[model samples]
Target: MSPLKPAFFELAVRADARWDRFSRGVRRRMGLARPLRILPYRGYGTAERVLIQARVLEDRFVKPSHLRRSLVGSAIASYKRYATVEIPGARVAVHWGDKRWEGTTDDEGFLELWVAPPPGVRPGWNVVELELLEPEPQGVPIVSAQVLVAGPQAELGIISDIDDTVIVTGVTNPLKRAWALFLTEHRTRLPFEGVDAFYSALREGHGGLADNPIFYVSSSPWNLYEHLDEFLALHRIPNGPLLLRDWGLSRHGFAPGGGHGHKLEKIRGVLGTLETLPFILIGDSGQEDAEHYRTIVREYPGRVRCVYIRNVPSRAQRAVELERLAQEVREAGSQLVVVDDTVSAARHAAQAGWIRWQEVPRVQEHQQEDADARTVLDALGRKGS
Candidate 1:
């Protein structure tokens, strides 16, 4: 990595911050600044400790439209997410049933509070209420962040990647990824079909009764957190804590293989946190997911039950490399199955007795339906053009 790259990136970030501060001041003078809202992300924890992840962003999230979106509308909504202004140094008071804790937002308007779990908290969704108490209370609204506490009966925890594995983001292909990020609406972004069924099956560990926890660990910046969350919920994917990393400021700067260490760190952190439960790691062959997951499988020994590598269509070299890593995973007393789609992974899971054998057909059926719908949509789009 060039030494100047970090310097230049810092310069750009500082410039953007200066512009935001200046523009925000102007908006305030004109009495037109966007309202301050507490944006709390979905968090997960154990019975003893819970993490609360949230941000203080200008209240500018565009409500996603249910009807088919025009390209213009999609572009506008997508751009609004990226252009959000952060409100730093805000004091937020967090409240959970009988417990209370307070924290201040950082320079990026983000807060992560690790507090003792509220007494008598169950294994399912628990609520954490956040109220912005400082900055003179512009309406001082209390917002709820649903935090999942894993139950002891969980057969195994699942850790998944979002981009390419779950959705069709051409991260390796810059132009395609840029279009998907900047213009594609959440409703329009395509998810890997049958993934919902497959994930649901895994989530239902035994006899369709287990309450397994799934955590999505992605290198995609936190700026896209809400978009990704909405996409998961829209597609009926089993929701979990999305552990996305922050943007830029990496030591490698823009160099290839810069940002992916975040995935390894997050994955490891999840495994370490829930020490008793083994994990099933799911990611795509795209970029470094395979490499990162393989590291977990080897390092954690029998802690990981299996690793599923979704084979996204791209360079042949990635496929070959992933095939090679499968042996390493198996040698570590675990399996890394490189599958072409959701159906294949579901089949493997069923055979492994991880999911009911009945779910195989449903996964296959959903995959076919999703593929057919995509074909129809493509044809319609071409004709319209």
Candidate 2:
């Protein structure tokens, strides 16, 4: 399949609008009832304020499945069984620490509210209760979500990409990427070698008291939030708020994959919120991460401590482009290191005093073991094929 261009997405937007209108008309004529459901996603905030977002959708039940399953079976189930029935014009009430914030879902059935955290609301995971408040007598009562509140003690923050950075999503090949996304299960997916250790070390920091916040900014759609969240926990990666994009069509246009503008905006929002702490940016060379990070480093001089770009085979030829970007980042007051593996990144982090020097050897050893495991898995796959 060829890559979709801007014109294709524009046409998709028009088609989607027509379909939506026709569906609404038919539903009205048939007097079909729509079920209501509230889906509260993980949120992030600070001691001063909290940001919470959720979507109102037509009710649909999804059965919980075990993490361990055949890749093909899992992919089939996910693609066929997932539902995204948005219900617009719904009012939602969010309660946290003696405060209640009310907001209405937009045309896309999404609601986002920023509320001040009351006194004595400490850091760590804070649970917020959400209830659908509109359409009297048919509202969802209690749906809870945890929000990570960054404390004042946090020394620095970490912003990293998802696909091709931590997990192996094969973004360079559209066909293979689609297959990995729709045909495989989260448990069956794999992360790059030593990423778990490298990220954990960043989270712990030098004295193990950094309690540094980590934010995962990914181009993946919000629908895959649960899957990615599970992958992180299962692989022992540090937990953080996932900033994902909505892949559906809206009044503006159809955004199949989160555009570069969307990603930059999301990253800027996080940087704006955490004004005091500097950040370490991590991404891969597979996408426009180099360009985006370059802009970030220029826009927020002295705020970005280090920029790490993990090399992908398809992007190897862009070494010159990356070198230029590296110079740009350096001129803007930050270091950009283009490395082929996570162990090198770990070593750099150690030298920069972001992590302990002793952790480097452990990361190196684990990476070697991961490589061996991959060799075995590849051999087994070949035999099966």
Q: Please, what is the whole-model Cα lDDT of each candidate in the order they appear?
A: 0.82, 0.80
Q: Please provide TM-scores, in order, for all candidate models, with all chains considered together.
A: 0.91, 0.89
Tell me the deviation in Å of residue 173 in model 2: 0.3
On residues 95-154, what C-alpha lDDT tens digit does candidate 1 reach at each position?
A: 998778889876568898888886778998888899988764778589999999988878
> What is the total number of backbone clashes in candidate 2?
0
How does model 2 score by TM-score?
Answer: 0.89
Give the distance in Å from residue 14's predicted Cα in candidate 1 to where it truly belongs.
8.4
| Residue pairs in clash, model 2 | none
lDDT (10s digit) by residue, model 2, range 168-264: 8898899988877677776667789988888888988887777888999987877777778889998788988888877667644556744556779
